[model samples]
Target: MRKRYAAQNLLFISAAVVLFAITSCKKDRTTTNNNTPVTATPTKLGLYEEAQTDNDTVYREVFITVTQIGTLTVPDSLSDQVFDTGSGGMVIDAHYILPANMITSTGFNFTGDSTVVDGITITNQKHIIQYGDDNNSTATVSGNLCYASVTIGVTNGNIVVKRLPFYMYYKSVDNNGKALPPHEFDVFGANSGYDVTFPNNAFITSPFSYFDPGTGLTKGFKMAALGTANFSDQNEVPLTPDVITLGLTADDLSSASGFSMSQLTESPPYGYQPYIPATITYNGTIVNDASILFDTGTNADNYLEDPSLNSRNAVVLPTNAAVSVSTTSGFKYAYTVGKLDNLTYVENPQYSGVPVSIFSLNFFFDNEYMLDFTDHKLGVKSN
Candidate 1:
């Protein structure tokens, strides 16, 4: 029997159990290979929805890409199997056919029957889908897969499987170590990819009305991080609704990976929030000129550390300030963050928590943005 788990309201984190702040930060939008488009046509797309985990409630969507391995026939009925995007849907436990050319990391375990023919490797793998707006959101897939010989794709390229029965195993504790009941729901799958571009003034013209079916949560796109960081330690505990975090410290940035501490920052604490060349604006005001890590996975909420240092103020605007953000590509977007939302902040011992002085914003799919891994750029969609 599956261990039943009770769902908890985890839309936002509790102030008492402060874990870590997750944000994705990238360098200023730079068009590499000058004059080339930075967006990739998404291979697949599915409607976004919210799910409840033991620790939190998350917005999730799944994308699938099926390629022919040899001569195996994938049922034509596969495309008809899509999951509902309703609030009550269950978390998906779907499988993926590992591509022969794909290089997987140590994060996954392979299982079940496997066969290789014609220099093609066929294996079943499990991939957990999350509501993500980044280019590398679905890069890592985990699970023990079971399958037989497969065929290589000849005609069908991508398929969006919707409204299907999907089950996920979950267990929770009532602040004590007690087991919870099992749950189930339906899910959909499809080939997932992002085709985004950040042309000038894109943020000003994009849509911001996003309604969360699970909690009736509505939000608009307001700000974006110039860069992002997940964790200093790759093996750190994962957030319930896993997200792409902003990269802090000198080591987090790919461009400054080889720099020494002395070459990174010249602060009293040295390396305490190694600088990032970024900026932030609130209601047309340049409140922050550097060190702001915009988080899209959360909400339009803002945080201000009590008794913040002058340097901290230089990078993040106070919660009392009018709320909004403008992008360098010439796009102006606004949001609403209440004045009472200020967090009685404290620094993190792990150097992993959202810094008391650092600012975090939520704008996942609130406004369309194209994430291009090929060019290492996050382009705000201006259509």
Candidate 2:
């Protein structure tokens, strides 16, 4: 009787131990912070090819989406600077118009996800377009939409990136209206990198003024364009006007000797007073009666040539021609130029002055020029 009673008690204790062990494991798993779910690695969206309009509008009209965040390497001079992908990213925008037939889908899974992650915010954005009526000088069209919030590391020289990942989605349909399978961008990764660097400090002055669109208030803008130049066609011909204007010496030309500035043949544009007369030598040829404007509102590299200058100066560059640039400060750089056919030149009747040619991205990036917004000056270095 004693042995049997002991056996029964042993069995009961073993079952209780098993039950306790099972309950403890369930409790630990449910409360553990380490078990939180993480988002899966993203994939790239699509690839694009450069396209042109009948009027010579140049666009990268291809469809693409970023699937991953990849590393961007900068110049060795900046090698000491460590850029964190999660926190140091900047917003990237592609202002483009898509085709009517293009198929698109929103990743519902990402809908409420943090628009900003590790300093990267990927979001959809738009711009407003005000069309001009018949009474107005010109009519406007729809503005562009883009994907924003990609982070980047700014380095000198060529940007060297090894593992920047982009997850994008795309689709093509058959003759029927049925939808096709979605595909991600895998090839666009090759051309997605950018090269950024700084220039010599001596070339520019500081305490620049910038325009705040949000405030509509003019404040000190830290960035400035060193000068402006125009692009030529594939044949190396100037796409627009040949006459170059030199804004008065206060901007740059004051101390430099050579050439002459003259009063305008007619009342100049509304905001512009007669520039203190000046002339400049361009491409070894002396040009007079030119209007020079150091426009901060302009992109610092290459911009579309004004249409008013179109018929005025159409000097073609030789096939595979290279254009050289020089400034009164003795800054110099050169690049092969290409024509932008469809870029429209806005000729506002209220502003009767010939459009000021813009020197923007083409020149800055090609020349390895850099703008220090914090210091408020433009700098250039050898490429």
Candidate 3:
């Protein structure tokens, strides 16, 4: 009798211990983790963080900062130094763009038990912050409903991420469609395994007033082909005409099939830019397989063409003569250069190897640029 009684008590104690362990785990999972606070720093931009939901579903969140034209009260974290001012005398700094390579969920690690994740979309936004368009510009940043580890890479040694307040124009809400607070970047402190180091300081000067002293022009602004400055997004219509209708490239496209090499190039996009094939023809001179830097960062219409050309003055591309850019999927982007004769013939870009041409900010007015990663295709849409 004594032996039987002892065995019963032992069984009860073991059961109790198991129950306690299970309960403790439940508490750990349900409650907000103190060690993993939502307010952590050093966020990994492309990784998604788990955000709360109303039901059994768990949703992920990511933060995106766009360059918008308006009264942007620079966050103290980013206002480290005075960048520049807008045409309206607003404090200006270069705009922050999500790393083109890091913004997708191509290699995201899923933690849940289920293999399928319920993806949600939030629409009817009053604006698209990218182009500062309030209406008509229907832009969708698509991917695997990327799980934003809610990580913001605010600092990395000497490279500090100074950004204007993140404007989530198209996706300012959570996967569950919850509106996110402005500048609500989620980074998991130092433990986040990712460290972002940019080749250049994106926020050095105001995107609106970013003056490339090398070329010598000003205005992080809406400029006419003749070179005028205007920065007013009031009433959803800024002076900078929303020229190109941008689209997020599909997820399955990549460079493996000789489509686009952007994903395989470098850690950053600006450093690598978009690599494409082109033929620049001027004054009856045609150079095929030409090297060109199709940069959207440049704001002026007059760009830096290869200085090797004979005509020092701006070469007038005869009417009906368009610079043809060969793109992935057999798409061709043509920039009809008949409009203006303001190109400044300068020394070829110091970029190693070949002489190159640049398609700057003004180029957007004439053509649509597409940088698709997962889909592995880069295309140019001629307007």
Give all TM-scores, in the order shown.
0.31, 0.27, 0.33
Tens digits of per-residue lDDT, candidate 1, 28-111, equal: 333457754333221212221223232332223221212322233334323222222111112322223233333233322334
Alpha-carbon local distance difference test for all models: 0.25, 0.23, 0.26
What digit string (tens of lDDT, one per residue) describes model 2 on residues 257-339?
22222222222111112122334333333434433322221222232222333333333433334434444334544444445
Q: Which stretches of candidate 3 lie over 4 Å from their true place?
A: 1-264, 267-272, 302-322, 327-329, 336-355, 373-377
lDDT of 3 by residue, 135-246 (tens): 1221221111111111122232111222221112213334344544433322111100011111222111112111111111111112112122232223322222222111
Candidate 2, residue 376: how far the Cα is off, in Å: 1.0
The backbone clash count of each candidate, in order, is 45, 63, 31
**Full-model lDDT, candidate 3:** 0.26
Which is better, 1 or 3, measured by TM-score? Answer: 3
Candidate 1 residue 92 Cα shift, in angstroms, is 6.3
